[model samples]
Target chain A: MKQLTIQSSSHAYDVIIGAGLRKKLSQKLGKSYKKILIVTDSKVSSLYLEDVKAGLPDHENLSHVIVPAGEASKSMEQYSRLLDKCIEEQLDRSSLIVGLGGGMVGDLAGFVASTYLRGVDFLQMPTTILAHDSSVGGKVAINHEQGKNLIGSFYSPVQVIYDTDTLRTLPDSEVRSGYGEVVKHALLSDMDWVKEVLSEDFSELSYSQLGDHLLAGIKVKASIVEEDEKEHGVRRHLNLGHTLAHALESDLGYGEITHGEAVAIGIFFAMKVSEKVLESTLPVDAYSAWLKTNEYPVEKLSNLNPERLVNRMKWDKKTIEDRIHFVLLKGVGSPAVVPIPEDDLVNHLKEFIEEVIQIDERD
Target chain B: MKQLTIQSSSHAYDVIIGAGLRKKLSQKLGKSYKKILIVTDSKVSSLYLEDVKAGLPDHENLSHVIVPAGEASKSMEQYSRLLDKCIEEQLDRSSLIVGLGGGMVGDLAGFVASTYLRGVDFLQMPTTILAHDSSVGGKVAINHEQGKNLIGSFYSPVQVIYDTDTLRTLPDSEVRSGYGEVVKHALLSDMDWVKEVLSEDFSELSYSQLGDHLLAGIKVKASIVEEDEKEHGVRRHLNLGHTLAHALESDLGYGEITHGEAVAIGIFFAMKVSEKVLESTLPVDAYSAWLKTNEYPVEKLSNLNPERLVNRMKWDKKTIEDRIHFVLLKGVGSPAVVPIPEDDLVNHLKEFIEEVIQIDERD
Candidate 1:
C-alpha cells in the first residue's frame, strides 16, 4: 500500500492506492462522520457495497444509492434523483457522500455531494482502473444531452480510497479502455516511462506493477492539478487527448466507444498534429504501433469523415470564445495548447486519415 | 453612487450601489467579456432588459433568458431548462451570466453561472431591494421539494451592480418584505444602525437613504462572508433570524409568505428567545412594535402551531447532527449560535406566540 497526499487550493487529501484498502476505510477517514451515503452503480453494488459498508466506522449512519451501470447513468435525471435521495436519507452538511464505483458513479456522486446541502463531506472509492484518473482531479459532472460532462464543478473529495482488489472484476474491454489513459499519462511524462509502459505486457502485470503504473499516472496528474487546480493555466495539458476524445464521443453517440478508447485515438491524432504542426520529432510510428497492438481502434479514423470530426472538435466545450484550442505535444512530455486554423486542420486531418488507412492496409 | 470593495476568501469584487448604476455597467466590468447572457425574470425583462443591453459594450455576443417571476422559478426544472438554454445559446467558458432581478433570479442565475461550463463569469444585477442581501453573500441556490436551498454552492460573483432606481417600482408589500432583511442586518451590526433603520418610516426613505441602508446591510453580510465564505463558524451568526425564517418558509409553503416577512417574524422570535433563554435584556417589545409599524406579518405566528414550527426547525438545512442551531443575540450587536433543547424550544415558541398575539390585541 502507498499513499500520495495531494494539496489542492481547497484542501489537502490523501490518495491511498493498494489491494484491499477498503478494509482500512475507517482509519483513513481520521474524523468521525456519522451520516454516510454510499453511491455506487448496480454492477458493483452486489459486489462491493456491503464490503465498503462493513469497513466504515462503527455507529455511523449509512445508506446506499445504486445507480445503473454505464455512462448513461450520468444524466440530469440521475443527478436530481440522487440529490432527492440525499434529502430522503436526511444527510446533512456534516454527512458523508461516498462515491463507490468507477468514474461514472464518482462524477455523479461527487457533483451531488458538491451541491447537496451546499456540499457535504465527499469520499471517492474508485473500483475500476478508469476512475484512478477521474477521482484524483476534482472535475465532477453529469452529462448534458448536447455534450458529455456539460454540467459539473471542480469539487475535490476529502479522501480517495482505491481498493485494487475490485479491478479484477472489470471486463477485458474495461481494462483496455483504462490503459489508454495510462499510456497517455506515460507519454505526457517522458520517453523512458513511455517505453516502460509500451514494452510491458498489461495482461502479465502483477497487482503491484499495476499499482505502480496507476500511481505514476496519478502523480503526473496530481502535480498538474496542484499547480493549476482551476485549469486557468498549465492544467490544460491534462486534456492533451481530450479535445478529440470529447468530439469522438459526441460524434459517435456516446456508449458506442468507451471514453478511454476514444482518448487513445485522440492521443494518436494529437501526436500526429504535434509532429506536423510544431515540427516536433515525436516517435509517431512507435506510438501508433503500440496503440494498434493494444487493440485501440485507430482504424476508426478511416471510416469516419475527417470533416465531421473536425466540426465536432469545433463544438468541444474547451473551445474558448469561438476559438478551438488543441493541446499539442512539442515532443514526448512537452505539451502546449495551440489554435490551428480550420482550413489547415481540415487538410491535415484528411491526409492523416489517409495515411492511417494505408498503414492498416499494409498490416 | 457608493462603491464598496468586498474581499472574500475566493476573490475581491466591488458592490456599486446607486440610482441608475446600471448605466455604468460597461465601465464597471473591468475587462471585456464578449459573450453575455442576461438571465432575468419575466417582470425584470420587461422593465430593464433593453436598458441593460444598451449599457453593455458594443459588438458583444449577447442573449437573454427570462424565467417566470416568483419563488417557484428556483426549481430543478427551471435550473435544468436554463442549463439547456445555455447550451442552446452556445455559451462558452468565457461567457458572463448576468442575473437581473430579486433574490429568486439571483439564486437561479448565480447557480447556473457557477455550474454552467463548470462555472462561468457571474455578475449580479439586483433589481429588487430584497436582493441587496442575497446578491452580496454568494449564497446561491435552487429549491428542492423537501426544503428551500437544499441544493446550492458558495460561488461568488465578479461584481454586484445595484441600481436603486429599480426600487421605486416595488409594491408596498415587496418593500416590507425587503425591509425585514434590512432590519436583520441592522440588528447584526451595532445598536446605532438598528435605531436609524427602526426609527425611519419605510414609505418615506429616499433612494439615497435606502442605498445607505442597503450598503450598510451589504457591509454586514460582506464582512461575514469574507470571514467565513462557506458558513463554517462566524458566518452562522448571519443566520440570526434564518432558523425560524427557513422553517416558516418551508411550513407555510414558499410563495405564500415573502421570505423577508418570515425573516422579520423569525428575528422577533429570536430576540425573545435571546432574552428568555440567555437572560439578556434586548428590548423585545420595542422590536415587536417596530415589526407592527413596518407591516411585517408577525401576527401569523399566533395563528400557526408552535409545535409544527419547532419540528420544522429541527429539519432545517442548517441543522448539524440533528441538532437545531439558532443564532441568538446577547444584546443588539453581539450574536452567537446556540443549540436549544427541543422541548424548551417548543415551550418558548408557544409562550412567545401568545405574547405576540396579546401585544397585537392590546394595540
Candidate 2:
C-alpha cells in the first residue's frame, strides 16, 4: 500500500491506495471513532456495502445511509434528509462517516459529514476511477437550486482507501467518464502521459492499464492540491479545463452532460485559445483529433451560444472584477492562469466556436 | 472609535465600536470589493438601510436583499432565497455583503455571505444591541428544521461597525433580549459586570446602559473567539448555558421564548447543577432568587421532561464519546468547562428540576 497525507489548517489525514486496503480499515479507524456511518449510493450499497461493513471491528457500532445513484442525489433535499438521518440515528461529533461511492456520493457525503453536528471524522472509500481525483481534494459540497456546489465547505476526510478491486464492476460509460478527469490531470501537468493516452485508442486499454492511468492522474492532482489546498493559488492550476467546463455544465444543466465530458470539451477549447493568445506550442488540430478518437463530442461547439457561454463564465467563482480567468498552456507541460477582460474573452469564444463549427461542416 | 481586531484563520476583521463609525465605511472597505449586497431584515432596513447605503463609496453597484424579521426567518428557505438573490444581483467573489440587523439578520446574512459564490467579503453593521456579540464572532449560520445553527460556518465579517446611534430605535423587549447574551458573556468571564447587571432591576437598565453592557460583553466573547477560533479548546467555554438553552429553544419551538429568556433559565439550572456536582462556590439560592426577582421564568423546568431534556443534551455537538460536557462556574468570575458522564448529567437534571419545582411551590 502507498500512503499519502493531505495537510490542511484544521487537520490532516492519510490516503492509502492499493488492492485489498479495505481489510485494514478496522485496524486504522478503530482508535479514532467508535461509531461509524457508511454513506453510499444505492447501487454501491447493494454490491459492496456489506463487504465494507464486515471490515469494521466487531466492537465498533455501525449504520448505513443509502442514497440514490447519480448526481441528482447531491441536492439540498438530500442534504437535509441526511442531517435528519444523523439526528435520528444519534451520530455525534465522534461518530465517523465513510463515503463509499463515486464523485457524486463522495461530494454529497463529504458535505453531510462536514456540517453534521458542526463536523465529524469522515473517511473516503472511493469506488469509481473518477473519484481518484475528487476523493483526494477536500472540496465537499451539495448542489443548491441556484447552482452546483453552491452550498458546501472545505472539509477534509480522516483517511481515504482506494481499492483497485472495486473498479471491476464499473460500466463502460462510467469508465469513459472517469477517463476525462484523468486526461484533465495529464493535460494540466503530465504531458508525457497525455501523449501516451493520445497515442492509442482508449477502447484498446485494459482495466489494469486504466488503473495505472488513474493512479498517475491522481498523483498529478494530489501534488497540486497539496500546494494549494483551498484553491487560493497553485491549486487554481488544477481548474485548467473547468472554467469553460463549469459554464457548459451550468448552461446545459447539470447531469445532462457528465462533468468529465464537459471538462473534456472545455480542455479542447482552452487549448485553441492558449495557442492563439499565449502562443503556446500545442497542435490544436492534433489535440481535437485525439479527443475525437476517444468518442468525445469534439463537435459540440456549434450547439453552444458564445454570448450565453461568455455570460455564464462571468459567474465563475475564480473570476474577479468581471474579468474571466483562463488557465492557459505555455507549452505541452507548462500551464499558466491568466485573466482576460470580458470583451476579449467573448471575442475569443466567438472565433473559437466559428472555427469548430467550420471543422464540423467539413466532417 | 475603539478598534478591536478579531483574528481568525482566513478571516481577520476589526470591530470599530463607536458613534458615527458607519460614515468611514468606504475608507475602511475601499476598492477591495466592486459590488455590495447589504442584507437586512425588514425592520432594520426601514430604519437604517439608507444610512448604511450612504456609508458606501457612492458606487452604483450597491444592492440590498431584505429578509423577514425574527428568529423564524433564520430557516433554510431564507438562506436559499438569499443565495438566489445573490445570483440574481450578480454578487461575485469580490462583492461585499453587509449584514445590517440584529443577531438573526447578522447570522442569516453572514451565512449567505459565507456560502454565496463559496464565500465573499462580509461587513457587519449591527443595528441592534444583540448584534454586539454576534457581529464580533465569525459564527454565521441559518437554523435548520431540527435545530438552531444546525447549518452554518465560521466565516467572520471583514469589519464590524457597531454604531451606538442605531440602538436608539430598538424596542424595550429587543434591548432586554440583547442583554441575555451580554449576561452570558459576563457570567462566563467577567464577574464584576455580572454583579453590576444583577444588582439593577431589569426595568432600571436604560437602552444606553444596555449598549455599554453589549460592548463589555462582546469584548469577553471576542477574546474567547480569538483564542479558540474553531471551538476546539477554550472557545467551548463560551457555550456555558447553550447546551440546555438550545434544547429549550428546540423544544418550545423557535420564537416561542426569546433566546435570552431561555438562556437565563439555563444559566440558573447550570449553576444549580454545578453546585450539586462540582461543589461550586456560587450562591445557587441567591442566583435563583435574582432570576425570579427579574421576572425571568425560574419555574419553566416543571413543564419539561428531565429525561427528554437530558436526551437532547446527549446529542449536543460539545459532547464527546457520549459524555455531556458543561461549562460550569467555580464562581461568578471563574468558569470551568467540565465533562460529566451521561448518567450523572441525567441524575443532576432530575434533581435540579425537582428542586426548582419545590421552589416554585414555596413562592
Each prediction's whole-model lDDT (CA): 0.85, 0.77
Runs with alpha carbons beyond 4 Å of true place in candidate 2: A22-24, A58-60, A206-209, A250-256, A283-286, A317-323, A341-363, B21-24, B27-32, B206-212, B283-293, B317-323, B341-363
Q: Alpha-carbon error at B130 in model 2, in Å?
A: 3.4
Give lDDT tens digits, candidate 1, residues B10-127: 7899999888877768888967876889999999899899889988876458888899999999999999999999898888887888998999999999999888878898999998
Residue A32 lDDT, candidate 1, scale 0-100:
85
Residue A128's lDDT within candidate 1 is 82
Over A1-363, each residue of candidate 2 has an lDDT whose tens digit, in order, gives 566676766677777777776666787663666578889999999888888888887544788899999888998789878877876666766788899999999999898887765677888999987898889878898876666787677788888888877887887566666777887788776567878777757667676677677668777877787788878888888887888888888888776677777787788788888988888888566667766677765566677887888777766653445677788889776889888888888888888888877876776
- Structure candidate 1, residue pairs in collision: none
RMSD of each: 1.6, 3.2
